[model samples]
Target: MKAAWYGENGGPEVLHYGDIPDPEVGPKTVLVRVEWISIEGGDLLNRIHAAPSSDHHIPGYQAAGIVEAVGNEVTRFKAGDRVVAFDWNGSHAEFFAVPEHYAYPVPEGMDLRQASIVPIAFGTAHDALFEYGGLKAGEFVLVQGAAGGVGLSAVQLAARAGAQVIGTASGEARLDRIRPLGLEHGIDYRNEDIAARCREITGGKGVDLVLDLAGGKGKDLLVKALRPHGRYSVIGAAEGTLPSFDFFELIRKAMQVTGISFGRDMHTPRVHQLLEDLFADVASGALVLPIEREFRLSEVREAHEFVATQHPFGRVVMRP
Candidate 1:
């Protein structure tokens, strides 16, 4: 199998594409011929040693592919099945092996390239909004970094659930892309104060839920934009700073704060259920994964470089 891997953690230059040993499938694993792999910030972090590191690591978590072979113990799928899998490394190769439980069947008629984007960004958005935040219809939701991967998914998911969605972006072009995804209001954080704009949009009641992916004093900003008993979910920190706030504010407003980290053990039946729901939405033409760009496997380094420099409107995928 051909793969792009790093023997040591450093920069994008460390990624080298060449022949690597094919993954040996375990009894509980399934071998997939990867069609498309989504490049995420987490993958970049792992490559640069900002996140977890492993020697000779192949970095990629979400992929859409066809099941080429199955293990003896695997019962959920067989050869030729089109599927999407989440949280699997080594997807930066022609073939990869993943546990059967982590794989989900892609609905018929859905583009595999688009379906590839759902496992991480869309899954995280669904888990944060419904499972963690307990979002209700007719409520107000605000998504920070709305132009990025998970942020765009959150915007659409929140809107699909009947919540009025507000988003924050850095420029007008990015905001314009977010508008058709059901964003009712957009704040240009570079030109305007996010908290103030959000407060004005809600008429001072604040939003019922706040998804803060850009950390900093944004925690305090979310607090200001959150209504009483609001739910605040922290998913990422692209802004590079941490802020402090008074504990009394939380007690007074009865607000809830949660930090979400993705891992192997986080899988549950509810996650499977949400994936099913999201796929159904996609099948009905209600949900779509906007592919901002695509790169070949050999251009993996360039893909990471692009994502690092420019904040794209949707996901960047690599066809391996």
Candidate 2:
């Protein structure tokens, strides 16, 4: 099968597109002919930082396609089924083999490309806003880095739940694009003071929840932006900066910090139901995720570069 893979961990330049041996289906795995690949933040992070599993490694988190075959032990899926699949790796290829549990059926009337991007972006944002952040109606929620996939997902979900949504982005245009998606206030993080803005928006109390998508030095500002005992959902480090909280920092704000790894819950029954509802909402236009661009699988390097540098509004997809 043709794939975009790398022999060493580095930048997108390390990636090579060519024909590699097909994956062997395990007893409980389903083999899919990938149609669309969602270029997730973790996919680039892994390419630049995580160690490769072999000399030439395929790197990606999720894709949507048709099931070409299934293992002997797989019961829920078979050939010709349209599905979106997730795994630690191997989605950056013409075919993907994932455990049966990691495969989700795309709802009827949903586009395959749309289904490809749903699970992670929506799941992470949903759990961060409700399940973990404990957001309630009329409360204030601040979404840091709100133009990207998960950021936009968060803005919509928070707004739909009746939480006052404040989001940060690079420019007025991007923030403007986000406001109609349920953002009550837009902070241009490049220019405005996030903490001061939050304090003002919440009448000196600060936002009830802070969803940190662009993890970095900005964490300090987010920490200041939260009310005492407010929840902070550490979801992504798209800025390529990781922030650590000290004891004093935590104690001073009385903040509750939680790390969100949506992949950890991908196989659970709860997540299944959550994605089902999210998918239905998306299909019905109650929720929306914009696709910023699309590229051929052979142009994997260019796609990665675009995502890292362009700050795409929603997601960039690649096709085999």
Candidate 3:
């Protein structure tokens, strides 16, 4: 099998594409012939920060394709079944092998390209907003880095549930692109003050919930934008370094901070049902995640670089 891999953590330059041996199918494994791979934020983060367990580590989390083979213990899936699979790594390859529990059946007739991006982005947003953050309808929610895949998913889901959504983007054009998805107020993070804007948008009471996706130096402002005892959902840190909570800050506001790692619950029955519903909605056109660009699997290096520098409006995908 041909795949992209790296021996050590570094920039995109560390990645090299070449032929590698196919992964062995375990008793409960589902082997997928990768068709479409979603370039997740975590993919880029892991390449730069996380150490590879082996010299030939293939890094990626989500992908959709046909099941080329299924383990004898896998009862729900068989060869030729269409599905999306998730693992800690190995999706950045021609053949992706995952445990049966981590694979979700892609609805029949849905485009594989679209199914490739659904589970992680939508599942993460859903869990952060309702399951853990406890977001309620008619409450105000602030989404930092609102133009990315998970950010756009959060905007849509929150709005559909009747919550007022305030999102931060780089500029007017990007914000305008997101408004149709249910952003009530768009804050230009490049020029405007996020905390002040949230206070103004919520009539000085501050937002009821804050989803911090772009954690870095700007994390302090997200905390300040929250109302007293508000919920803060820590999702991702696109800026590379994660933000730390201050002891006094936590004590001062009596706020709730929850770290959301959707992968932790992805193999559960709860997430499976949630993803099924989300997939149906996306296939029916009720939910949309725009693909800003597509690249061949061979161009994995260039694709990773584009995501790191471009700040694309929505998700980017690669075909194998």
Candidate number of the best TM-score: 3
For candidate 2, give the lDDT of residue 210: 93
Clashing pairs in 3: none
Model 3: weakest 10-residue lDDT segment is 44-53
The best-first sequence of candidates by TM-score reads: 3, 2, 1
What candidate 3 gets wrong by more than 4 Å, as runs, is none
Candidate 3 C-alpha lDDT tens digits along 5-89 = 9999999999999999999999999999999999999998899889897999999999999999988999999999999999999
Any runs in candidate 2 off by more than 4 Å, and if so which?
A: none
Model 1 misplaced stretches (Cα beyond 4 Å)? 7-11, 48-53, 240-254, 262-266
* Residues 1-320 of candidate 2: C-alpha lDDT, one tens digit per residue: 99999989888899999999999999999999999999998898788778999987999999999999999999999899999999999999999999998999999999899999999999999999999889999999989989998999999999999999999999999999998999999999999999999999999998899999988899999999999999999988887878899999999888999999889999999998899899999999999999999999999999999999998999999999
Candidate maximizing lDDT: 3
Give the Å shift of residue 291 in candidate 1. Answer: 0.4
Q: After superposition on all CA atoms, what RMSD does each candidate show versus the true structure?
A: 2.4, 0.9, 0.7
Estimate the lDDT of model 1. 0.82
Q: What's each prediction's TM-score?
A: 0.90, 0.98, 0.99
lDDT of 1 by residue, 1-320 (tens): 88888877767788889887898999998899999998876677667644434556778887899999999999989999999876557788888788888888998898888788876787788777887788999988989888888898899989988999999998988899889998999988788877788889999888988888777766677788898988888877656455555779879889888777655333677778778887888778787767789999999889888887777778899987
Count of steric clashes across candidates, in order:
0, 0, 0
